[model samples]
Each structure stands twice: as structure tokens, then as C-alpha cells.
Target: MRTNTFLFTVLVISIPYSLSADSFTFFNYYHDHMVLQKSSTGTTIWGQSSKVNDVVHIQIDNKEVAQTTVSSHHIWEAKFTSPSDNTPHTVSAVSSLGTIHISDVLFGDVWVCSGQSNMEFNLHGVLNATAEFADSANYPNIRFLHVHRQYSASPLTDIDSVDAVWNTPSEKSLSSFSAVCWLYGKYLSQHFNYPIGLVETNWGGTRIEAWSSPDAVRRCAAFGRKRNQYSQSQLYNAMIYPLLRNTIKGVIWYQGESNAAHAYKYSCQFLEMIMDWRTKFNTASLGTTSSSFPFGFVQLAPWREGEANLGFPQLRWSQTSNIGYVPNGLMQNVFMAVAMDLPDFQSPYGNIHPRYKHEVAYRLYLGALGVAYHETDVDFEGPFPTSARIDKSTSILTVEYDRGLHPIEVRSYNGFEVCCVNQTTTFCNAFDSHWINVTMTSHSFASISLDVSSCSHGNHVTQVRYAWRESPCAFKQCAVYGKMNNLPGPPFTYYVH
Candidate 1:
């Protein structure tokens, strides 16, 4: 009987011992070749451990950053002061279980590029992709952390996919990398001469609602039906929430194709998504105020079927008009990269995925240079019409733009259109014969004279729109450039009294 008791006791002891043998380790994000955010404070290094109350020491480049004990929950975290210089460093996390050493880590700006298929469009599919793949070896400092596509019923602490890891830019790595992100990173790295880290979290053909939190989606009454249509908060819970601990410079989004059906509600939904992310990220990382980081997004490119139904234009207007909805403090940090001129024109009907990703990336890079980097001499935004007035006697309409204007490439301005209140039809009179001579009065104003006498109705012109059509390409002629950077102007619309 005593021998039997001894064996049973041994079995009991071994059971708990075996369970405790699980080793402590760093999160998947903290891996070799990872680039931490430079020129910023409050960068965190975190992981999980099986041992409780055990100290975890973090060292960067042989210098100690901090030492913290693993909590009862088996999680450990430590924040380190980021070095001001851009250089490669090795980080080591030592615990009772073992020592995890991350090598070739870089200190530089890190950005999160998230959206649908366009953002997920791989570099391998882009034009001149072969040349780009061969040339990728030139920029070793640019690193990419690609998050595998995932969805969960509840928020997960970490993703389980093996492909999610930081990778140095190379021919092999470039194959799966986002094309727009690669171009943006290349430009920033070349211009700034520093390391640039990109966190790619996107799924092809996914809607903005799919990426948004359930709470955020529920807050908008317009999305009530949509909330029940799919698994609410699946993507946000699985993909985005896990990265809340990561410190980033900003986010560049290229979505809106899926949300075109609900174009009217997009303004509020998009705003809420931005605010929700900003609030959650800031609160999780720094416990600071909302709207703490910058956000830049690409306005939807013109699609073939969308033009016939006028869906793309409505979505574009929704995106542009909501820029002011975000608080003023954060509004200045918000940027919209226009793609009205970047769509594929060679096709009888334009393709949704434009071949010219370089132009898209260039536009985004210019915005980042001005907003995030604070380059004083960069002209990121095109001419935006601020105000307009009508002279009833001469039947002349003068519109004032924000950025200084120049003469359009073509003498004829094809984008300008007019609408009269008395018109029975809702459609604006587009490319009408009434529009005579359009002239640039100064560096900031344009004048358009209309022949009201030719109108069937005697009502004065109540609205004027430039490049506001579904497949708007007319502004290509009036591509005004800023003197600082010489980038072309974006399309605009004006309401007249």
C-alpha cells in the first residue's frame, strides 16, 4: 500500500511539472530584422512567459533598457527610450526560461499600411515588378512586417500565422510586399536617409466595416443591417488589436471600393474608424489623448461600373467632405491622396487597380513629407477651392483656391460644369455649351463666365463643379503645381449663391 501511494504521488507531482515546462518567449512581432520606431518615446517590448514574478531584462545594443517582472497573468512588458539616431542594434530579452536575442533591429520611423485589395496588391503584380524586385537589394534598411490574414470571434493576444514577421527588403521579400507601401517606403528612405518600417495588415476584397470594431460599427445607425451581415469585429479583434502595443508614426489607408454602396454613410463610418483606431492605439500604448497620430488615405480610384452609376463620385465626395469632421488639432494631420488622374485610361472602361502605383505612392509620400516629417518647403496638397461668388450682372463666377494656381496644361478646361436650381433633372449640366472662357485670374483664383441667357430656365447658376464626374479626368489639363514641390493639383467642387 505504501509503494502504491508513492507512485501516485509521483504522478501527481509530474503532472504540474510538465504543464509548467512551457517556455517564456517574446511576441512574434519582436523578432530579428524588426525596426523599432525612432525619434519617439514610449516604445514597448513585450512578450509572454510561463513563470510568474520572474524578472525579464531588456537590453538594446548591449545597453540595458529596463527590467520588469512577469505578472501573474504570464505577460511581461517594458518601455524603452528610443535612440535619436538611425542605426542597427541588437535587442536581448532574458528571463528564467531562456534568453531571446533579436538581431539587426533598426531604429527609424514605422508606419502601418492597412486597407483592402489595393493595399494588399502585391509588388509582384505591379508594372516593372521584375526590375523592382532586382533593385530591392539596394534598400536594405527598409523592413516590412506582414500580418497574415485572420479573423476571430474575440480579440486575440497574438496571431498564429507563421508568415507574420519582420523582413529586410530583398528580392525574395519584395514578392509578397505591398506595392504602394514599397514605393512609399523607398521614397521616404531615399529622401530621409533613414530606416523605414512598414506593418502591412490588409486583406483583399475586405470591406472597411470588416476591419472596424464591433462597438464602432454599432455606434453608427446606418450600419445596422451591415452589422448583422458579417462576423462583427472579427478582423479588428484578430488583426488590429494585437498591434496596439506597437508604436507607429502614422497610417496610410487605400480602401473605399467596398463601401461605395453606402457612399452617403461613408463619411461617418470612415471618421469613426480613424477615431477608434487613434483612441485605442493611444490609450493602449501611452494612455494619452485621442487623435494623437497622423492618418493619410487614398481617395478611391475611378472604377468602370461605378462611373455609369455615379457611385464613385459620391464616395469621393464623402471622403473629401469629412476631412473637417475630425477635430482641428487632428485635421491638419489628416491627408487625402487624390487618384482622379491616376486611373487606367487605356482600357475602354478603366480598371479598378491602376497600373501606375508610383504616382499613387509619390502623392502619399509628398503628404507624409509635409505632415508627418514637417518639411516646410514641400507642397503636399493641390489647389483646394475655399470660397466662391457670383456676379449676376456680368454672369461671372470667381472661385478662390487655397494653393497658388498656375495655367493648366491644356488651354481648354474640360472639367468645369454648371447646375441651375430650376432644372428639373438632378444631374448637373456637364460639358455644356454655356461654359465659354475659363481663366486663371491670379495665383489663387479662377474665373468662369456662363451665358445664363442660353439657359431654358432664367435661374442663376447655383453650383459649379470641377472634375466632379464619376470618371473625372478633365482636371488632368488643369494640373496646377505648387512652386515648392511642383506636384499637380487635385479636383474640386464649389457651391455658389
Candidate 2:
């Protein structure tokens, strides 16, 4: 009697195990309440099934869309036309094992919010967390998929588990969602009146090398030790590669604090990273017309005071220069969200994480409005110094800017600093005396008159730096802004000829 009972128990346990092994299931991202990329031509759905070579049927809104067979590797994929209209529809996948139904899937714009700690910063950690969390229930169409942090030495086919699945924003989820991404999606959803999908992938204190492919980093000679020391392509393999097949509108990056030490090499490293992502994700589903997609990023906020060794300024310059230095054939779609004025002034000497994430989000939204959406009327950037000319007669440097810039509001002329190029030493030295004065000539112009007589190197001012300190706000009270939009002028240094 005991032997017979043991045999029956073994059979019962083996039956369910065999049945489950034969079943098919969708990728983790294809769960219910997901949002498909509406702007793309089609949406690609992929899954795995135990029954290889079996036919798989796909349907959207009960209409047959595609039919394909599972591959020898037990993997299957189907592409379905996504309607331009942002309406919710039911998606289903049927195989020999069974039929899986996904409910409440919408077609809309999808954006990937990625970076380090700032991008990973949650809504509950920002200012006015309670009010924002309570108000999040109003936007039911905004969905979020928070990709769990993971790393691997080799590329991964899929993540082991996802922290958060696709769901409409609620008080519970909003509190933990990325604050900048949440606010950005909220603004876009209100303006476009469509569902917005955000994929949050980030790791705190991670350098740019961690997010880039190993081969790409190895190609750049400047990243010598970085290529071998860190786990090459670990984050890219585990976090990004799995989602390359998914269609996305663009990416919003908010990193660089960790890469500040390697600021000189950032321009090449960052550009390579951008091109790498564009090349990998440029499939039919994600769109292939353009070699690159729109990429917007936040400039590092102010940090420690007078720490030039930190390379914050150098990193900021590299970020801005990348807007114009796109790889050949790739579209010039890079944009920057300046954060010079967004840092917390109370603890400018210590605080690196600014509490005012809403402003940062708004700035990123403005950049997307102009660069991605192509809104001509939107003034997305502050007054940028376009060209500078030095008048030998009067020793005055006049800097020209783009249109729509208002007069620079100067609390004090302290941010302006002059560096004299020493012919004998071949080095530029800061002027010892008060050798510069700034004057707002017009609504869109400014002139800095150098005191050539007071300069130590006779009239040879090699460079002029404006608000270029590590913490200009804290030390020099650097206050310059666009009168029209009230946006602060980005910190910059100019070479005088």
C-alpha cells in the first residue's frame, strides 16, 4: 500500500511540471496594460514556447495580424500594425500549448528614461512628494515600466525579473517612479492627449563606461584603463540589450556625476554611446529612416565650491559640444537641459542631488518640444554666447547670441574672469586685479570690457570665462538669465582672438 501511494504522488507532481514546460509565454514587457509605440510603423511582439516549430498566431482587437512558427530555439516573434489612434486594445498570442490574452494595451509614444542616480531618483525623494503622489492618480493613461537593475559580463537575452510592470500611474507606483520621467511624461500626455510609456533603466553611481558596449570603449584609446578595469558592457548587456527590440521615441539621460573625473574624454565616450544605441535599436519596429534618434540630457547641477579638479565644468562643456558633433549620416538630434540654476543654493558646497526635479523635468520637456516635436514657437534654450570678438582699440569683447534671448540680468559683474596668456611661460594666468567689466548692450547681446592697463600681461587676454567656476552661485553670486523665459545662461568659456 505504501509503495503504491508513493508512485501516485510522484506521477501527480510530474504531470503539472510537464504541462508547464510545454506552455508558451510572452516577454516580461508584453504584460497587460502595456503601451505600444504608436508613431512607429509596426510593433514587434516576441515570446518563447516549449513546442518548437509550432505555429503561433497573433491578434490585436480580435483581428488576425500575424502568423509565424516558433523557431528551433523555441523563440517566436510577430509584427503587427499599430494604429495611430491612441486607443486601448486587447492583444492575444495563441500557440499549441494555449492562448495568452493581454488586456488594455494602448498605442502611444514610448520614451526611455536612463542615467545614474539623478535619473533614478524617485518621486518620493523630490520636493513636495506628498502633493505629487496624491495628484498622480489623475493621470491614468501614463504607464511606467521600471527595469530592475542588473549586470552581466555577457549580453543577456532577457532579464530574470522586472521590478515594476506596465501599469497606469497610481499613488502607490508614483511615489517610487522616476521623478523627472514622471513629470516629463505628464507634461507630454497633457499636451498631446495620448498615453505615454516610460521605461526607467538606471544604476546609481555608474560611469558612462558601464553603460556602453565593451567593444566601443575598447575602440577609444583614451579609455585605456576603463576598458579593462570595470565589468565591460555589463550594464548594457543586462539592462539595455534586452529592450533594444522594443520601439522607443527617444532617451532622456541624467548622468555624469560619476564620469566627471574623466571629463576630457567624455565627448567621445558619450557620442560613441549614443551611436551604439542608435545602431543597435535601428530596426524596422523602432524606425530606420534616421541613423540616430532624439537624445536629450540634463547638465550636471552645481556641486562643491572651487574644486576645479572635479572636472565638472569640463564635463558640462563636452555635453554642450556634443550637440553639434554628430557622427556622419546620423541626424543632429542631441539636446541639453541646462541645470546651472537648478541646484540647491542652501547647501551649494555639499549637496549634489538637487531637490528641484520639476524644473529640471520642465527644461527637458522644453527641449523635447523643440527638438523632437519640432515646435518652432517654443524657446527651448537660454541665451547662448554664439560668437565673441575682441576690439583691439578699446579692449572690449562683444559676444553675439541667437535670436529670442533677452538681456542678461546681472546682480553683480563678479562671474566674469580674465586669463592672460603669458608668452614667456606659454601658460594662461588669472588676472590679479579687477581687469574686466560686463555690460548688457541690448536684449540679445553683452560686452565685456577688459582693463588692458590693469592686466598683468599687457593687452593679451587669451580667454574669458563667464560663470565658469565649480560653484559660481555660491562664491561669485553668478546670476545671469534670459528675461523672456527667466532661464539662466549656461556656464561657458570663450577664447578671444
Q: lDDT winner among the candidates?
A: 2
Alpha-carbon RMSD, each predicted model: 10.1, 10.3
Give per-residue CA lDDT, model 1, range 235-319, as digits (tens): 7777787787677788999988887777777776776777778777775655321345878888777665325455566777677
lDDT of each: 0.69, 0.70
The alpha-carbon lDDT assigned to residue 58 of candidate 2 equals: 95
Clashing pairs in 2: none
| Tens-place lDDT digits, model 2, residues 1-497 | 11111111010001112225776988777878888777545677877788889999999887888888987666677777777777788999888788998999988888999888889888877778888888888888889999898886666666646889997888787767899999999889888888899999988788888788765676454442442223457788778777876778889999898888778788767767876677667642335213467888998888765555437767877676533221113335777777865556554323777778888998888888888888988877776666666777766666655534435445544566556545553334322343353443333334334444334445466666666555666422345566577666777776666
lDDT of 2: 0.70
Span of ten consecutive residues with least summed lDDT in model 1:
4-13
Residue 109 of candidate 1: its Cα lDDT? 81
Q: How far in Å is the alpha carbon of 299 misplaced in model 2? A: 0.9
TM-score leader: 2
